[model samples]
Target: MDSMMMGAMSKNMESMPDMGMMDMSVMQACMDACAACEQACTVCSTQMMDCSPACMNCADMCNTMMRSMMRMQGMTPASMMAMLNACIAMCQVCMDECMRHADDSDVCRMCAQACQACMDACMAMKDMMMASA
Candidate 1:
């Protein structure tokens, strides 16, 4: 992460009530993965693949998830859980969609890999939160 982003995350983490329950390292990894997945999905969607719609939706969701993590003060445990569930659902759709075109497009394959990584990271985050709770 850039210095600016690190500063922003530090500032945001200060007042986050639920932040205490979260593992900062895990959160950072998930947030990064989500951001990457969003960018990859966006670029891949523009290629006019058959999965364009799903990729577009996943891109938006991943971006939102990334932003939400950065601004942790606005979230509660319930909100965080909901966001995690939504992200997982979006990732599932994106991975499935992208996998359909993986054989024909390198971008699609990479996008699917990103989505899978993001999903795994998010799930790990949820597990961490649960363990802390």
Candidate 2:
């Protein structure tokens, strides 16, 4: 999924000024992580368990973050960084909530893992952007 999307994104990247310094691979990884996190959170939310609210919130944030990255035409670096921070924060909250029941629930455990991965990917994207800047 990411590979195909990345291919399409690459063409658009050429039109964005200073985007040559951005690493498409990192963006791809971030998008993939967001997609995975969204799926995990959605499934976890359906359990109608204690962490459902946080999972649902994280899912929404992940989807927004992924879409923002996809539509970067008017996005500034500062705005992107802010969005990444927000996504990371949401992921952290969801992970903390999910981890509380990880010992008893496989879905919670998987959701926690997905949140961690999404956080890591967002951080990586931020780091790459800073380095490029």
- Write down the TM-score of every candidate: 0.90, 0.95
Q: How does residue 22 of candidate 2 score in lDDT?
A: 84
lDDT of each candidate versus the true structure: 0.88, 0.94
lDDT of 1 by residue, 24-118 (tens): 77888898899999999999999997888989999999999988887777788889989999999999998998898899999999999999999
Instruction: For residues 24-94, write the lDDT of model 2, one tens digit per residue.
Output: 88998999899999999999999999999999999999999999989989688889999999999999999
Colliding pairs, model 2: none
Residue 70, candidate 1: Cα error in Å is 0.9
- How many clashes does each candidate structure show, in the order listed? 0, 0
